[model samples]
Target chain A: MNAPTSIKEFFESGYRQFLPHVSIDCAIFGFHDNQLKVLLLKMKNVEGWCLPGGFIQWAEPANEAAQRILQERTGISQVFLQQYYTFGEPERNKEPNLKDLIDSLNIEPAEDNWLFRRTISIGYYALVEFSKVTPTVDLLSDECCWWDMHELPKLLFDHDLMIGQALQTLRMQLNFHPVGYNLLPEKFTMPELQKLYETILDRPLDRRNFQKKMLSLRILERMDERKSVGPHKSPYYYRFDKNKYDQALQAGILLGF
Target chain B: MNAPTSIKEFFESGYRQFLPHVSIDCAIFGFHDNQLKVLLLKMKNVEGWCLPGGFIQWAEPANEAAQRILQERTGISQVFLQQYYTFGEPERNKEPNLKDLIDSLNIEPAEDNWLFRRTISIGYYALVEFSKVTPTVDLLSDECCWWDMHELPKLLFDHDLMIGQALQTLRMQLNFHPVGYNLLPEKFTMPELQKLYETILDRPLDRRNFQKKMLSLRILERMDERKSVGPHKSPYYYRFDKNKYDQALQAGILLGF
Candidate 1:
């Protein structure tokens, strides 16, 4: 479906059903091929992109609304999603391209339409394995895909600010929580996990020291299986021991930044 | 001054100006006498108490609303404030004692009163020195004072939940930020700072190890002068080096839990 159809349906069917002046946006970060990616929705007719977001139903909780949006767009479930921040600056609705976004959709919004009002958006983010999700476009966008974090297109409204805050929160969360395990495959080499951490942190870490610090936390269990990549020496596959990882998280796993 | 007058004025003069469906609550933490305390307001003519909070204006940013609420209640300014979480559960406004709270004020709310709506509150917290603030009662309460963290009165609505989340955030923030400096008086003994941390973390730490860790951060300057207590050996007074503290904060000072 394209912009005109989506806008037509929104005015006829979905506009009034949304909770006024409040929405939820999810910054679903995915990891694959040693690169960090974020799930974004490409606006059908407009040359813009935004995080997969949806309005809160008046009867539903904000968190439940976020979960529903993520499930509807990406088909990922049972992941721990955290609410990082609320973006409610009044000027956010006055984005320069907002008129273009509306015009491209080929619909004139009524004065009473909730889209014209300022919105208070709650941001929720999670780290997920890229292979787990089958991205599907919802009524609001034509295409949904994972884009590299560094090469993101300019987003609608204050979504760029939302992504920046999510990344900062994830970096701080990395120091106290073992988050890399879920973003990687079930059995992955040490280099893969280290590379994931380095990407999220946006810094280079000493290989030997990183391994030593990670091992001392006692959360990762080295598997007997080994993976041979090309002509390089084989590396043992390691997985997180769930119980120990939880315990370490509660005890404050301080990673060297 | 009291609930009757506050409520009378709220109905007579202040009921319609609040931004519908959104508010800001501050868990203003204060440190004194080596104990952590939170600023709470006692509900006049009712048995419940709650944190200092206020509603956002329609044209105001949430952060500005929080700062206004904090300043209006505590008479303090220019302190570091952090927005930690937004509580948007639908059932939060369905508390059983809400009627009692309204009834205690002896004013009948209009059918369209904003107070009857479900509000999503953004929680912001800051650590401040107790002596700096001269707490004042707002139009909704009779008394304002610092309540010990270990012993808190039953709070109204989901304020208790907000305070709990704020404390958890503060504990995590303390791990990487030099927050003790603002909460303590200038030129304090090492033990005083340690006690403040212990109180906030709700756990004890080794005296020598805590001192070593704090000193190594290089944000505190040891003074030649010392204070004597009767026959006890004088403990050296130390003050925070503001420039060094900012540098260490920028560099991410990691304190052990």
Candidate 2:
């Protein structure tokens, strides 16, 4: 999609009918090369970055809006999306560089300028396999790509704080929820699962203890398949036993530290 | 405080400057009489109960609004409050009884009637000691009291769904976070703590397993004093070691299932 032809036409023909101060921003997390990555959008005609986001329709549920934005930005659908937090501070819209970015865009300041108004955004996070995501840039952004979580650039409008909170929520959910499977291949070895957890938890876990904990959950099925990566010996592959996984989800699991 | 004498006067004198279409509702949970209870408001001139909730100030954060409303309704402050979920279905205002109640209130149907408009409320859940609360009725409600969770009255709007989600969130948090203390006295016996867990989890736990799990956390300090409440023998009382509890909270704890 091309950039808006002009500021006036953008307002008249754009998201005018959408909810004015409500939006949904997504932290689409993916695991690649044993490292956690987050999808970010590079703003058009500006040097700042932000999460891929969109305004919610007046009649749309917030959760549906999140899924729609996730698919529109990354071409990934039906993934594990969760609404984790809402960022609604009074001064979130008054960030200095953001104001400058709006000014540079040549968008005239008007009371009806929904783009510049204070927005209370609902934050939704998704976990998808890195190989499935094909990032697409929309009219408002120049590029969309994954950034290393540890080497992220300065993001606009409290997005950095949003990412921080999202990461915290993801980490907390990892202990009890069956989330690591979403970031991995359909079939993976135990070691690969361990690395995913280590990357998300940001710590080294005892391999045996981790294996025992995972195995005891009875949610993984040992497949009659093996794959060798690098010079390491072939490790047995496993996939989630969907029946057992769903049962455990319904009953809930508690993994200890 | 008394109920508003007239609908016009109510609109002119109350919450006019707050943000439209956004509010905060709190499920203030209390443990009493060996059962879990939720504080609910009996709507005035209506046959429905609802969670104590209020509008968010345009300048205030949603979290602060929840705290303010919680304190206003229950006279409890500085309690454990968490933003568990946000309810934003498009047809939430179309609930039959709620619509009828609004219609019977005899307020003029205006586009700006905040009470009758579609609202997306952020749901917050608070855990407060039952004894410390002094429930107060507000202008919108004729009565405010604690209702047993097992036997809640038919609530207005989608409040019943909100409460169920809040309970699920609380039950999940119980496994990892130290939250039972917020519902108990400064010094509590092992059975008291166990009973609280049973109430939250809504199931019986093995006595030895529960005791072992709790004691292994090292957050409790045995108190010097003990009391006998009935024919049962004196059970040892324990108080949380605040320093240790805070440290565990910072480092994070994962209690196994």
Candidate 3:
């Protein structure tokens, strides 16, 4: 099946090429300047923002669909993407009047169109480097950009709940999965690593305890290089030992604060 | 919408009452006699075992659908159910001859019936008390029973893979989520608790170390009672403090092995 050429085609015949009532939404997270951010899209003619989402192609694996959707929007692929949850409330995609919303976009379909059916969305959260994303909008979206995690605008549909669940899963994952592999620079200071954790966890950690806990994981390799601030206050740079980090992830070792 | 009353009705017009191409399968795990077990069902005319699964009702949430399915199969409800993964490989449900499988069971449908479409299954795993369950078969199943985790027979419809992923997720969850709350009796000896972990982790742990780590988490309360084994081997019983266990789960604290 070929890709739909227009929004009208997507509304009318997308079920021919894609699985109906099943979609993938990504909560792309990036870390920069001691802040956490999420990728959001402003839908065309819709007032509120939503996570980048798309239906699964008939022949594509759902995980691949997620990666494809992310790449289409962010021009980034192969980043650390984890399927955290599936949002499937009967009214998750329900609008006050979906017909009115579709009418505003100038697409009309039968009352029983596949798009109007209840959708069960698989939620995936990606950890991507902040600087590498080139945000691109889909046909339905007018703008694609990152918003501060703490200051997101009102989201459409159940997206606000989706983001909250994704963030909660990400925080839970921090207990076992190594962080900063995709979100942090290759060589970063200890404080930078701690800040990333603090931002995701939304709380402060005792600096010494955080550093001690991280080093105890044995996945981080201290580099001889240092980020110099003052002569006496330079923090040594560190990089994740990719092999060890991968091993720890596979082993599911707990790296608690 | 009412559920299909017969298998033929299910194959014919089930799509009207249920979400098409999306279903929920539960990997119901129970612990007994220091062994971990999973609930499996035998289809009416099929030989292979399978996890308990059912389609989501058009009016129901996926989570509720899972609970309903589990309750229908095991006569157990309100257990510790977790949505761990969604299996959407496009071919995850493809059979060598789905028509033949249905034919053997004496059902017939059109070539492009909704049942023939590719399905994306949401996988949820539940922890249920072994003694509390009274396995029951659905309209399409003949027998339902518990099988040892290590000694499971051949499974149907990618269920073998589903169980593997569910177990992996459950093992990883041990880092943050309290286990044995649903699988164990209200009071269990320390050795019994250790056995549960060892069985799930598929490895042996130092008994002293395991007890020390579990005790340090502060969620377990030592009961005044003891399980008398021998004059020299009476181990005290322990029960999870429901409040602290729930709090720890909410806080997502790392309870590393």
Clashing pairs in 3: none
Please list the residue runs of candidate 1 whose C-alpha ends up more than 4 Å from where it truly belongs after superposition. A1-16, A104-106, A230-232, A249-252, B1-16, B104-106, B110-112, B230-232
Model 3: lDDT equals 0.87
Docking class of 3: high
The lDDT of each candidate is 0.82, 0.81, 0.87
The TM-score values for the models, in the order shown, are: 0.91, 0.91, 0.94
Candidate 2 residue-wise lDDT, A125-238, digit = tens: 888889889998866677899999999997888899999999999888777777666677789899999998999889999999999989999999999888877687898999
**Candidates 2 and 3 compared by lDDT, better number:** 3
| Candidate achieving the largest lDDT | 3
Model 2 residue A207 lDDT score:
94
lDDT (Cα, 0-100) at A141 in candidate 1 = 77
Q: Comparing 1 and 3 by lDDT, which wins?
A: 3
Candidate 2: TM-score of chain A is: 0.89
lDDT tens digits, residue span A1-257, model 1: 22224566765556446666677899999988778899999876666788988877666788888888888888988786889999879878666545666777787877656676667889999888789899988776788999999899878778899999999989988887887757777788888888988998878889998898889889899999899986888999999998998898677677756
The residue-by-residue lDDT of candidate 3 on B1-257, one tens digit each, is 67788889988998888889999999999888888899998876666888999999989999999999999988878788889899999887776445545887677688888877899999999878899999998877788999999899988889999999999888877877778787778899888888899999999999888888888889999988888999898889899999998898777667676
Give, for candidate 1 chain B, the lowest lDDT window spanning 10 residues: B1-10
lDDT of 2 by residue, B1-257 (tens): 34346556666554445666677889989999989999999987778899998877767777887888999998878887989988879778666434455566776555565565567878899888898899998767779999999999989888999999999998887777776667778899999999998998899989999898889889999987887877888888999988888777677677754
Candidate 1 lDDT over residue span B1-257, tens digit each? 22224566666555355556777889999988777899999877667888898877667898987888899888888887889998889877667435666787687777556666666788899888799899998876789999999999888888898999999989888788887667777888998888888999999999999999899889999999998966877899999999998887677778856
